[model samples]
Target chain A: MKRRWRQLIYLLTATAAALFMFLPAAAETPVEKGLAIAREADARDTGFRDSTVNLLMILRNRHGQESIRRMRIRTLEVEGDGDKILNIFDSPRDVRGTALLTYTHKFGDDDQWLYLPALKRVKRISSRNKSGSFMGSEFAYEDIASQEVEKYTYKWIRDEVYDGLECFVIERYPLDRKNSGYRRQMIWIDKKEYRTLKVDYYDRKDSLLKTLTLTGYRKYNNRFWRASGMNMVNHQNGKSTRLEFSDYRFGVGLRDSDFSRNSLKRVR
Target chain B: MGRPAYASAAVPLALVLLLVFFVSRSQACDLSGHASVEGRFFFRDALFPGQEGNSASVALQPEFYHGRRDGSGLTFTPFARFDSADPERSRFDIRELNYLMLGDHWELTVGISRVFWGVTEFVHLADIINQTDYVEDMDGEDKLGQPMIHLSMPRDWGVVDMFVLPYFRERTFPGEKGRLRTQPVVDTDRAVYESAAKEYHVDLALRYSHTAGIWDFGIYYFRGTGREPDFLLSADSSGKPVLVPFYVQIGQTGLDVQAVLGNWLFKLESIYRTSRDRNFFAGAGGFEYSMVNAASSGVDAGLIAEWAYDERGEDASTPFDNDVVLGIRLALNDAAGTEALIGISRDLDGGDSMLSLESGRRIGEAWKIALDAFFVIGSSEGDALHALRADDNVQVRLSYYF
Candidate 1:
């Protein structure tokens, strides 16, 4: 009777160990968890047909000298692909009336065109410089673009509390390793709204290069959440760029025709 | 004297009328302007007999717009420049004085404006709408605004633009005191027009542009007075050999295409021009590849190469016939907006070559400094640049915006 009881206990212990070993693999891996989180975040942000917003960009140097630039942005979200964005500068006098138009794709290279008011011409630009600073600002071109899910592969990091909000930390590695300047990026998303609160960018050398923090969340249309301010700080250069967004208008009924090159000349 | 007096009085009268119109619709009108002072100093001695060593200039451009959100608007941009070295270089232009109305799929614009069309970097073979304002710069980028009525219609396949240009303006020429000039001075007063209508000739242009994925393509057809004037050597009133500009009517078919792939951009501009004097084809094709954030230093560098060809070869008008150009561009991606470019063009026929360097950076908030250098080597007697071979020099320009 004693031997039979010991054998039953051993069988229970072995089964418990086996379940512990296979549970995480069968339920969810780190990659699966990360992708699921990203998918959820992206799904929540969809259905915004079009939006227009006014932006004020403040650039500060190491010496704390600041220069302000005012611009307006119009964006249209494509159902299955990426987004189309138009940025028009209004102030700083020298760059006034300059406009940049971009059409991003899900898989391949994006398209960009720049309109110079002084020249009264539109120039097609190469969009492979995703890591280059945008208009001499600390924000790289890739940073301002819509973050497509397929552009990067993800790994779920541990969760942590940031700014008194429970957040999930995820690390993403760019799929286009050769073109991207960043090796990986760590993103902190809040648990309640899945809104991105902070991001740490690592350069190709796997060194921390910049940190981007977003704050001042304002809900619009009772469904869409827009950040009022975004601050990017370069760790190596001690320079920073801050974007303050205001006057957001959504669902303006903008069509694909409005984003054509012909409209670029007619944009006010 | 009568014409000058009338012209001088007409400017102020028009200004007063515009001001009155804006003041009457104060709620819809917005006024903005910028004034700039520039100085150009030559590093070498004067190339021509009457040329100066340095010059100073001031320019004022004021833009006024009255419009609504629905794309109905009137815009007026009046530009004026005053140069100390050459009176011919100083002039006034209505860069854009147009009334635009936009509909669901069509747009109409009436009045004077500027239009540019091209894809290549070295030469703008497809750009023919506006006459080159040569006195403003040697790169042929500056243009004299054209008076026209334009209509554009966008369709699923492409966008079509039609232009009806009336009342042509004569091209301005540099004075004898200017540095870059031909051996014989150009006599603008003796300008000849092939059409009996002269400046009243009606010109027309049609263009179609489309973008498909990575490629952008455009085809344009223009039937009008040629912007480039044929030089006829004649005796001036001073009994000296002078070049008379003879404007001729011509038909031009132009094609411009650009393909963006990865970090490379390929551009091409080709044009076929037919006129009473001659029929010829010219083209420029180039490619540029950029290395983004080279070595992770926050700098971008682009390497460019282009080939320019003309059927007329040595008899071609400009210096870009059968030439190869290689250039490099550097962007410092800094707060000061620093950019530098260097290019060298080699003539395949005569071994003559030209090298150019341009660099610019902004200072403080509203100030900009630019440096430009041009050098020529081994310009044979039959080469087009032989006349200006000795004119190699550098110039420094400082400008204050607004």
Candidate 2:
């Protein structure tokens, strides 16, 4: 009996020593881990040009009623810190020779240009408000473009489970002093892929304003993850906007020369 | 090859309905509406040309509404003005009384509203019906108050709207101590010289909007004549015209399109109008009646490239119409409404160009103060400037919003 007790005590001591060595490491805060994961994911694909196609439908509320109006478009994206996006329309209303180009920067301001086929002219657009709805739709101009890491000051909030996967919740606040439609945003980043699965936006008064969801992430190139669709629902206005991205191709020989102001005039 | 900016009324009523439902409900019900008062106390620098005059004006703008935004709301807005520079111009203006449904997509509004029309360097929309031209210093003229009805629906697929503005009444009250000139009336084109006793008028418009791909197309049509009141005419004691109606139109039609794809933006607009009789200073009779048949069409396109010095760039909340515009606008963080804009434009006619510099600052969030100094370079005969018979006009203005 004494020998058995001695053996049990010895086993207990070894188990306690092993746990003592691993507990502190397992107790790392979610915020620190989330930030590190996001940083690493952003670094993996820092520079690339992508081409995509999308089917667009603008549903307007006329007299409080809704309907679906269809449109198709092709897009070219050059991502740095901010993203440079160009969209060309196809099908419906026969606006065959129209082009829209947007250059979005991370810390500075964004710029837009349009080419008209009938007049053969190009115009430059200013980027003053990123919060204003895009083309009167629920999605703002800022919502459609690239989201840089520096636009907001992030704080790690907590760890939670979403869609059966572990996630880190982070709060992001705009560093800008301009009047904003929202105050802060809470995002849920997946721990595994670092994909943003959901976001809750607060208004200037810190009231919950809107919710955005990114769904259907598909793994690309064995390491890259991309969201197939995104949706934003305005809590105050009871309106929602959805974006579907398709036919994405990566690593095209797109150059900065393709994104010049003079190119707006020559767009076909 | 495209429709003019002033095409037929293609804005659907559904769009207005959506707008009424969403915008009115965005803010929780407070007092429904509020009152705003503002004045511009200008101290003219006598050393400057054309600006050697000082002026002060006091204005009382009140807005009132009844009923909850969820169901039935009726809003009324009225304005009263007193000016030291023009004591003869003391007046009261009825801005609007717009009514909307609780949860539906429809609204009925009565009073004066700016009609959505025209696209030059700036945007001019219908239903923005307050007058601050002399103070704001923009070139576009003002249309006087008229009893009207407006309806709209704000949605995504398409929008429809309709409006009827009646110019039925014009009764000038005698000044507290002076005789009233024949209750002034503006007759089509004849407003330049002759003054009429009072006349009836009517304006009706319809608009439709639809989205196809990245393109938004709006078609609109407006028909009316002799709706501008004579009291507001910029004329001298002898009725020597201080300004002439630039277009000869008893009726006008327009079409406009807005498209966006990536970084490229395109806008196409076209307009046509019916000819009317006009009065001009022909050197002999001071003014003579002449039939003028004319129409003008213009288009503007632009492109811009945006780049960032750092990987993590910035995001902003303000919207600047950079497409088709060539200039720089700077706004300081500490100054909420303060901004400086420097602009240059190459005229579509390949004739003469224009340059404008403007600045606006706010004393507070609710009050905005602005100054505009404009210069037109390479002016030629028949240019926009020479056509308007004006040059280098400077203006300063202040506005308060509730």
Candidate 3:
């Protein structure tokens, strides 16, 4: 009986020791760490319901020429799927009253519609053109869409400081390689808020193409964090775009119907 | 003459009164407007006797809206344009003077408004709501807003819209001095109407539309005076051979569908129309495939091909009957918003063809420049476009938007 007890204790000790060693080893791997961080960030961003924001985009060329565009964005979050977004332009008189509707999916391609006020018609835009610039801005269609966690695979690099704040430096590779313009992206996310602070995009040739920086983050509804300004600079072209956001309203009772094609024409 | 003058003055007086009432009563009313000045220069000389080689125009479009947060609104949009070269093109229209009320499952609109329905790129075979403003452009995209009471109801199946058109609008035509015209000028003052009610004939339209997955479908029916007029060769008071437009009653049924799959878009538009003179069917089907970021650049290029068919064969009103169109579109994806498109339509019955090129780019912030070129070649003598075969021209337009 004593030998039996001794054997059982030995087995318990061996199992505990194995777990102690394996847990740290698994946590030390960058892939696992990165996935955990992404999951946490995604969880923290859930349940936003809906949000509306006004944006002013300033574009600058290599010669320092500047132009400005104004638009409004409305978003509705869907559980277990991607979000629905509506964008309405309010400036540059010619494109005024133009609206774009997007329905993103967690997997596969997204659906997009462009309503041209001049033609008084809604055209179905190819969502495969996600890599193309949006409305002459430096931002691509994918950049403005609600980023889905499943669209990429993540790998944690190291902990670093960005803008004087502690951040988790991670790398993410787009899962839809053919449609994505970037080969990979390195992101710096703040530790406390899990809000993205900076991102560096690498081209298909694995060369640095653009860098995006976010600043002036403000908390909304005591839970959601939003950046007030974003700047994207193209390394090759020496051109840049700055987005300034204002007039954010949350939980405004936006429903699925409000994001429909019918509502696109009615958007003021 | 006295009654007509009074009726003309009453419209403006009523509009002014409505504007005053809305502004005084609704605190949430918003008023906005935009003015554009455009200059168009044609490369070719005048094709007709009284036509000019260049023109300048100014347009003002103002909108007034009074609404609450619940989507109930009264909107008035007044559009006016003055052309220096073509008096017939200079006009004023109440584009949308309507009262809109919305509910959870239904919406209602009353007054003058515009509705467009079609999917194909080469031709809009299913669009039949508004009368064509022919003098505005040859593409048949510009429309004169129609006076109607529209009601739409949304259900699990689809959205159903019913329109009660209270009046008919005469299709406008190019003047004698216009660049694009027939062999004989059309006498708009002597137009004939099939219905004794004339312009007072009430029309009706119904449409059901729905979208599923990547496909959108619509079915429509319209019963009214046909917008396309059949001409009768007659002599005017001056003893000149003139085309007298005859507006006939028609019943039309239409279908439009679009499917978006990956980088490809397929569209189809079909219509069947019947009139006292003849019954016929027309259709247009096409596809557009795009290559995003072609050759590692930010430019997007799209290839478009479409087939258009009409049952009337050689007797069809337009030259596009039984034709095929192929085109390419290029989007620069630059800060200047540059885009260009080139298309060619070849008539299947003959070797006749029409080639068109359109390009536009923004200048700085408020200015835009557009270039358009059209060439008609090898047209048969009997073809409608044969009259203006030498009218091939290139136009450059510069516009300032505010």
Candidate 4:
């Protein structure tokens, strides 16, 4: 019985030592910690290859008037840069067959194209308007675009419990000041899943402008987590927008040609 | 050759639908489009003898689309209009009815389709595929779909589009009582063509387009009967003075280029043509610079400047010849999606000026209102816009989408 106790203690010590080695180092700075967390989140989402989603956007003004816009999104992942995305409008019948194609980059401005079905024309549009509202919604183009780790500089603010989940509060400053609408964003990410739960957007004047809450997250492919709904409320104007997502297909076989400018005309 | 080259405008759309109906089995078809009612008010008295003032019109454009799981689809769009002031404007058109099949590196579209090619604000010099629906609007931005078999191949370097246009649709003109019509009106029933095939002319067109880095360019060649008609002063069957529309055969080579540099966009469109009667050159170039979210407001303002030049100069049939246009575009970026564009064009040689405004706002969910105005001043006898000096008009349209 004594021999068995000694063997069990040895086994427990070896397991504890191995777990300790795996823990994050205590000497990490706030900036380093924030960056590492972001990198890990990004790395964990690398191999989704392609995805398709159906979305509904509800926009409401302070007067209680509401508007609706429906669309479909198809995305293809890239290895070293930003992803390629296709946006096809399904409602507001005038723009039903209209589509937009975007090829985002890691460092520079993205390339975009807009197709107008009435004219049967494809127009190359400028992407410097990242701060402009998308489809007249409260959500800006920068908010929906591919999120790359290189787009911002990060700093860990603190740790907190949000909605019964332990989270890491981090502050991220926009690197592309010329185009980005925000000066900085405060984010709360779930510690267990690296999923972002909330964000506070500060305008260029460094004033609190909007707050976004993400909810109804579901695991995709047993690896990636996606929010089923996102709520954005503007503090300055009392306008809010809710984006509801559904019918998600991950790792869908989308070819590169489907994201080309030629394909922009075929999004009927 | 080719069974007499017959042409019937309404037959092909029906044929396309019949063919696709038998092939479609597993998809739900969708119906979508817009219906609009508009009122136009003329600021001045009509200039021509038969011209009248103030008009009301209703327009409907409906689209039906069916897609299969095999990457093939069928689409049908039909347009109809009724004008209170002009009989010619009360007409129907098969705007588009086509079957589209997609392949790995290629795509094919059969039946009636509309294709547009150009990069300009006021005029698209390089676009010549479909005949203009001139009776629809004064802006000449509307087109009637053409019967075609289009094949496109996408490659790493560029895209090649080839078209086999089987039939030609005649250009619509304002009726005798229309405000924008010529004095004697065009006698379409007695129209003549340089080719004996007339509306049965089988035109061919091909274009090679490339999107490189920040530049998008298309070079094209078109061999066909020209859409623009030169009117010959003649007499009607009853011996009254009339204008007979005449079409000519022509070969055109055109190029359109655009460069996107951040907030700035540069555009150019040029066309060179060789016809049995004459050869000419027409071109336009411009730039648009946008200021997004300016002054911390959710507003975008874009400044535009363009110059149009034609070898025919004052003798050119279009008003864009030898003119400079300056414009501003604004968007509110609000939930209502409000936008406006205002432009003023000055003729260099004739020294006349024209002003235009197009503004729109979305109402609730599926309704919208638009206001458009056009004004011309000091139009000389030799100027292209001389025919419509007293036809300055403002139009208000309310639309419902479904």
What digit string (tens of lDDT, one per residue) describes model 2 on residues B209-269? 6555455566776766422222344554576433332222245455666555443345455
Top DockQ model = 1
DockQ of each: 0.70, 0.04, 0.66, 0.56
Chain B TM-score of candidate 2 stands at: 0.56
- On residues B262-289, what C-alpha lDDT tens digit does candidate 1 reach at each position? 8999999999999997899999999999
Q: What are the per-residue Cα lDDT tens digits for candidate 4 across B250-324? A: 999999999999899999999999998789999999999988888778898999999999997765667888899
TM-score of chain A of 2: 0.76
Best by lDDT: 4
TM of chain B, each: 0.93, 0.56, 0.92, 0.95
**Per-chain TM-score (chain B), model 4:** 0.95
lDDT of 4 at A184: 94
Candidate 3 Cα lDDT to native: 0.84
Q: Judge the docking of candidate 2 as incorrect, acceptable, medium or high.
A: incorrect
- lDDT per residue for candidate 1 within A1-268, as digits (tens), equals 9999999999999999999999888879889999999999998889989999999999999999998778999999998999999999886667778899999888878889998887788989999769988878999999998899989999899899999999999999999888887999999999899999999999989999999999999988887889999999999999999999999999998888778887788777
Candidate 2's TM-score reads 0.44
Query: Candidate 2, which segments miss by more than 4 Å at Cα?
Result: A1-268, B1-52, B86-90, B102-105, B115-120, B123-136, B141-145, B153-157, B168-199, B226-249, B276-326, B331-337, B345-354, B364-367, B376-402
Task: Give the Cα-based TM-score of candidate 1 against the true structure.
Answer: 0.94
The worst-scoring run of ten residues by lDDT in candidate 4 chain A lies at A18-27
- Pitting candidate 3 against candidate 4, the one with the higher DockQ is 3
Question: Of the candidates numbered 1 and 3, which has the greater DockQ value?
Answer: 1
**DockQ order of candidates, top first:** 1, 3, 4, 2
Give the TM-score (0 to 1) of chain B in model 3.
Answer: 0.92
What class would a CAPRI assessor give candidate 3's docking? medium
